[model samples]
Target: MTTAKETVAPSMLAADPLTDSVDWLLSKLGKHIVMAAPLGLGKPNRLLNAVYRRVAADPSLKLQLCTALSLDPPTGSSSIEKRFLGPFAERHFGKDYPRLDYTVAQRRGELPPNIVVEEFYVQSGAYLGARQAQRSYNSLNYTHVARAVASFRVRVLVQKVAREPGGTRLSLSCNPDLTFDLLTETEALGLPRPLLLAEVDPLLPYIGGTASVDPAFFDRVIDLPGPTPKLFALPREPVTDADFAIGLYASVLVKDGGTLQIGIGSLSDALCHALILRHTRNADYLQMLEALSPGLATCDLVQAQGGTGPFIQGLYGASEMVNDGFRSLHEAGILRRRVVDDIAVMQRLNSGNA
Candidate 1:
C-alpha cells in the first residue's frame, strides 16, 4: 500500500561479474514465496520438494498450485510450452494446480479458481474499428481491457519501481507493487472497480515498445524470483507463401537504417528475414542511398556507421514475451538500448543518426 522510489548500494557486482546492476535494482521489491515446485529449478529439484513441503505445512496461506511452466531458452516449435510446463504441473500440483490462463493483455475467458491472471489492453485503431466501426478515428491511445478489469475494484500489482538515484528498477524477487492507475481510469469512465489482485513480477524482462512501464509506483513488494514466468510457446498458424509476400510488403514501410519495434510471432520474423535479404541483394536501393549521401554509401561507412553486416544491425523488441529469437539477437550484440522506449531513439535509428 505504498508508492515511492528506492536506493541501494552497487555491491553484488563486486563478487560476481555476472551480477547485473539491473538485477540488484530489482531485489528491493519484495515478492511472495508462492509455495510450489516448478518442473525443474536448474538443481536436483531438491528446492522444489522443500518448497512443496513448506506450502503443504502452511495452512494460513492458500496454496493454489500452478502448473504453468516457462521453459528457459525456448526452442524447436510452438508446442514446446506444453511440452515443458504441462508435464511439470502434472507431476507436482496434480489436482490442486489450476489450469493455465494463456491470454495476453486481455482476459477473454475464465481463469482457474483462486488463480489470478492479468490482462491489460491499449487503445488501437483496429480494436476500435472492430468494436465500434462507425466511430470516428481519434488521435489518442486508450486502455479498454485495463478499464474493465479495474471496474472489478481489485488491487492490481505493477512491476516498475524507480529508485532514488535516477534510473528505474524492477524488484529482484519479481514481486511487484500494485497500483490502481488503470482502475482509476476506469472509474473516470464511470465503471465500478472489480475485486482484483495483480501479482507484479518486477523481474519480468523489460520490453521496448508500448509495453514499457515506469518504475516508481507500486503498492507492495513481494519476494518473487528472477527470470519471472517463462513464456510457454503457444500454438501458431502455419506460415504460407502469401504470408511471406505480405510480410515483404510490410517490410517496405521500414527504412534502410531505421530502428524497428518488432512484434512477437512468425510474421514478424518473416518480415525481419526479408528485410535482411533485401539489404544484401538490393543494389538499386543501396545505390539510391549512395546517390543521396556519398559519405554514407561507401562500403566502410555502411559497415561501420550504418551497421552493414551479414546479420541485422539492431532491432528492438517492444512486445511482452522476450522469446528465444530475441535472446539470440541480444546475445549477438545486435541489441542496444538507446534509452527506455524513446521515440527519438527510434527516429535517430531511422535517420541513420548513429
Candidate 2:
C-alpha cells in the first residue's frame, strides 16, 4: 500500500482484503478494471474475489481478467468420485481454502456479461468440457505472457507475496517471475505504470536471490489478520513405473554440470528423485536404469549427452515456474549453482572462470 506516514511502518501495514484492497484498487484504476494474476499458488484468491464481487454487482463496472493456470479444487463428476475427492481436496487443500470466484462462476456459465476471463494455460483437461473457458483462452507463447497481458492494457497486477525479515520487506516469493518481468516490459513500452498490489501470506517461505523484493515495490498491500489463508496445495500423484523409466532415461541425458528445469507433478517428482538417486545412490540408480531396459543404458543419446554419475558440480535452475520441484532439488544439494542476474558475472561463469 502507499506509504502511510501516520503509521509506524513505512507500508505493508494491515488492511482489509475485502474493503481496503478493493476500494483502493477502484480508486487507483477507476471502474474499468484490467488485471493480471500469477499462475498457481501465487494468486491472491480472497482479494480477487473481493474485486470480482464488487464489479459483478454493478452493471456499469467492467473487468477483463488475464492470467494463466487458474487453479481450482477438483470436484469429481460421479457421486462415488465426489465421495473420494471431497476429502482428498480438503486434505490437500485446507478445510476452508478459497477457490477463485470468477473461475467458479465462469465454469458454471454464470459469469456476468461485464466480466471476461482470459487464460493462456489451464490445468490439463480441467476446462476441456467448459466451452466458455476454451473460447476465451488467450493462446500465446509462455515467454510472451507478460507482453500479451500488457497488450490488453492491463493496469493492475495482484499477486501473493511473502515477508522478507522483520515484516518490512516483501518478496513476490511464489511469483516473482511475472510481476518483475511485466513491470519491466510495461516500462520499456512507456505505458502508464500498473497498480501493483499484493496480499501477504507469512506462511510462504522467504526465498532469496531473484525473488527478494522490497515493500516499496507495491502500490498497495493488504496483510489480512490471522487465521491466515492456507495456500492450495496440489496433491502428490503416485509415481508410476512408466514415470520412473522416463525419468531414468531422461536423467542420463543431463551432464554433471548443467542447468535444470522441471514442471510440477509426479513426472517432475520422478525426475528429481532419479537425479537425487543418481547422485546419492549411483549403484542403485544405474541398476534401475539397466533393469528398466538394457537398451536405455546403452542408448547413443544417453552415452553422448549423459551418464550414470553423481552431479559433483550440481546444476543451476532457471525456469518460468519455480515450485516444489526446485524445492526438492535445493534440499538435495543438486540445485546449488547460483546464476546471478549480472551479465558480466554470467559471462565469467560461462567462460569457466568464476
Once fitted onto the true fold, the runs of candidate 2 whose alpha carbons sit more than 4 angstroms away are 1-17, 295-299, 342-344
Predicted candidate 1 versus true structure: per-residue lDDT over 82-154, tens digit per residue:
6876666555444232222222101233222323322222223212223221121222222343343344443
For model 2 the TM-score comes to: 0.89
TM-score of each model, paired residue for residue: 0.37, 0.89
Give the Å error, residue 270, model 1: 0.8
Clashes of each: 31, 2
When summed lDDT is taken over every stretch of 10 residues in candidate 1, the lowest stretch is 35-44
Please list the C-alpha lDDT of all candidates, in the order they appear: 0.37, 0.81
lDDT of 2 by residue, 1-354 (tens): 434311122244455546766777777778899999998888888888998999999999999999888889999889999999999788888888888998888787788989999989888877766777888998888889877777777899888888877756777887687877888888888898888888888788788877876677777666676577677777778999889878877888887778887887888988888998998888898888878878676678777887778877789987876678788888888888768889999888877899
Which candidate gets the maximum lDDT versus the true structure?
2
